[model samples]
Target: MAFEHPYGSYNVQGSLNEWFRVNVTGNGIPAWMPSAFIHYDFPETGLISGHSGHAFSLTHQGADPIQQYQGRIVGDGQRGTLMESTLEVNCWLSREKAGGAYTHRLRHMGDMVSYIFQSARDVPLTNVYGSTTDPENVTALIRIKPANEQPVLPDPNPDIVRRRFLIDYRWLERVSAG
Candidate 1:
């Protein structure tokens, strides 16, 4: 019988991420609230409350930890103490029937993670270090405006325009005060 290498290499370039998993336990998802120096971007709607605004939230239920939105770690090494399970990202819109619940997904690169969270079904979460260069992702995420709607100025926060958005986690940090 001829001897053959059963483990012969086929292709191992970008297949490593196929099994990539990380459990981020840094106080869970942050509660993002619009800063006081902010202006109304979208039209006047109940979606964004005048007080707290519509903060984003995550739910472990139905949240798949297989691919995206999967990270776990312990108190050992660079990991945390508890093995925080991944969660499903959902939002609580102040305005009824304002936002759309579209199938969201997460994308990761190295240690940095980006969410596929979108308010409307059309919008998609764009990663900062990703190649999801679909402009629709932004438009879809924001509340669609009417054709006759007045044009608005660019957001002061450049991050909002960039694929990587700024999610204010200060609220989380405050509550976690030592």
Candidate 2:
């Protein structure tokens, strides 16, 4: 059963090529699960906030290892500013159980970033099974606009045009697992 998921969004106003850091951590889940640290850059105007350019590093607990992925935001030059942008991310995940594998064609729209993680093995005597013991997906959306422009509603942060949308696994599905 597919459902419509709502993610967070962020709005940041500045010149193109500006750099930002996105930090992610695990909550209510195993610390050993994969987490990501992302550094992104806005290459130019008219490009979606997510599409600009960015680097990502995947980290896990109890292991002195990290895997890196780099991606770029490509858009049609003909499209004017405020146009929708599509981003494609290609990265690798390394885990004790799964080892290293490539993830390609993961697409993000606007400023939305989605992460799906699964356990390598499920615990016996439990509903958990297969490569993913309990699958979790988290998504974040970022919106960048002019500070002076008045939104339909009052601005939460008037200083900058930034807003973030966040959603987790619990919101997406009603499943109990360890």
Candidate 3:
């Protein structure tokens, strides 16, 4: 996928793997999309790459009621929630940003656009979620509209609001080459 990086000037190339088990909640009731994951290649030479799981299956249930909707929102990075639910977004790794080591924008693609400004840095979980802590776990936040479209950051036009997901990059693992 190739698009302008939200934070820097670079193009994300290559297919993204399935990384980070994300929980979809907070922004909407009965969640529009399911608790899913996304994957990214370690940034190299200003060229980065990644993809949402199952980006091209064409499985979206935007119009259907919440009960009938099934998960699998991943789609091509540009489209509408009426047509496509999830999208493969542009990402970057930052050294100056305090929010996280990496950041990516998850967008609700349509005529009325909205964005989830995700920021994640390395943080070891010791006794946070459970009795056992994983070293690979990293804390991340997906900042939506009110949180994302702030004075200091670039505005994504908050008038058009959409469902957003809060992401946590836990259990860092490589996407298998199989």
In terms of TM-score, the best-performing candidate is 2
Superior by TM-score: candidate 2 or candidate 3: 2
lDDT of each: 0.21, 0.22, 0.22
lDDT of 2 by residue, 1-178 (tens): 5332222111111111112112123222223233332434332342212322222321111111122212211232221112222122222222222322111211221122332222211111111111122422232222222211112342343321222222211111111221
Q: Model 3 residue 100 lDDT?
A: 33
Can you give the lDDT of residue 62 in candidate 2?
16
- In terms of lDDT, the poorest run of 10 residues in model 2 is 8-17
TM-score ranking, best first:
2, 3, 1
Off by over 4 Å in 2: 1-23, 26-29, 33-35, 39-81, 95-178
Q: What C-alpha root-mean-square deviation, in Å, does candidate 2 show against the real structure?
A: 22.1
lDDT of 3 by residue, 1-178 (tens): 4332221101101111111222122243123223332333332332212232111111111121112112323233321121111222322222222123112222332101122223223222222222122322223221122112212333264321222222212221111222
Q: The CA-based lDDT of model 1 is what?
A: 0.21
Q: Candidates ranked by lDDT, best first?
A: 3, 2, 1
At residue 47, candidate 3 shows an lDDT of: 28
lDDT of model 2 at residue 64? 17
